[model samples]
Target chain A: MENHLKNLRAEKGWSQSDLAEQLDVSRQTVNSLERGKYDPSLPLAFKIARVFALPIEEIFVEEAEDKK
Target chain B: MSERIKSAGKRYRLEFGAAMTFYMVVLFGAKFLADGVEPGAWLTTLAIAPVVPIVFACIAFFRYYGSLDERERRLMSDAAALSLVIGIFTALTLGFLKSFGVFHFEWDMLWFGPFLIALWGIVRCALLLKR
Candidate 1:
């Protein structure tokens, strides 16, 4: 899944560590998510979306390959 | 904060230190006391040393249950699996060497082998967590 997490976090002036701290996860997890190397679980995705006050759909986009 | 990670790392270090100290004390103490004694005496202590750490680690794991989230658990499981595979291969190779008289059998190998295996496994797991 592609996400606007990096963009949203940037707009809020929050670093990866800051977002990780707020999400109660390791900074590496946040980094991996931003880099698209790892996909967050549903609950974690919800948490991220909630943090940015955006809907999950707006924050995460499912690619055509992901559908297959 | 970073403090929490530091604290967890410190606690892990302390636990590992204590385990190693206990392992060495039991191992050396048995060897010292068993001077000219039967082989069973030293063997018993050697067998007990590795088990001690596993029990302590289990206790620590249960005590800190909620602290580890899903991602941490997955990393740990993967690491443990990798460690088991490596350990089995090492055991088989060592066994083959011993049977062929290529390597002499020693009591220390039993303790050191598992210790290194577990240490390497945990380190690998921690690295995977970062990815």
Candidate 2:
């Protein structure tokens, strides 16, 4: 899954560690998510959306093939 | 997210530590016990080597039962599945070679298999933590 997490975080002037602290996850998780090496779980996605005051779909782009 | 999962993590650490200590003690104790004995003494050490780690891993498994959230559980399950596949493939390949007389079975390989399995499991856990 691709995401605008880094963009959003940057816009908010939040570092990966800051975002991770807010999300209660490790900084590596935030980094990995931003780097597109790992996908966040639904709950984590919700938390990220909540942090940004955006919809989950806006923050996370799920590829059509991944739907299958 | 849940208190149960948090406690499960704590339990896993405790159990892992205990199991490691037990394994070290058993491994070294058996070696010391058989130091002056005749041949086949090393066999006793080899035979007893796997039991501690196996028991430790089992305890970790049971402690995490029903405690992992969806993501944590998925990562763990996938890691274990991968580890099993690797471990089995390596063991089977070596076993086949031994049976074909390509190489004689060395008692050291007995301990080596479990070490590989444990190492794989640890690496998986570390990756999950990294995430």
Leading candidate by lDDT: 2
Rate residue B34 of model 2 by lDDT: 68
Evaluated on CA atoms against the true complex, candidate 2 attains a DockQ of 0.14
Give candidate 2 regions above 4 Å deviation: A64-68, B1-19, B26-77, B107-113, B118-131
Local distance difference test scores for all models: 0.73, 0.75
Q: Which 10 consecutive residues of model 2 chain B have the lowest summed lDDT?
A: B65-74
Each model's iRMS: 2.7, 5.3
Q: Candidates' TM-scores?
A: 0.70, 0.63
Candidate 1, number of clashes: 0
Best candidate, TM-score: 1
lDDT of 1 by residue, A1-68 (tens): 67788999999999888887888777877777887777789999899888999898898878874577
Summarize candidate 1's per-residue lDDT along B1-131 as a digit string, tens digits.
33465466567667766776776776677667666666685667755655676677656655443455556656666676777777778778988998999988774665765576666677676768566
Q: How far does residue B48 in candidate 2 sit from its true spot (Å)?
A: 6.5
lDDT of 2 at B63: 69
- Provide a comma-separated list of chain B TM-scores, one per candidate: 0.55, 0.61
Model 2 agreement with the true structure over B15-129: per-residue lDDT tens digits: 8788888788877777777667676857666657758676886777776655554455566677777777777787789889988999996757667766766867796877677
For each candidate, what's the DockQ? 0.38, 0.14
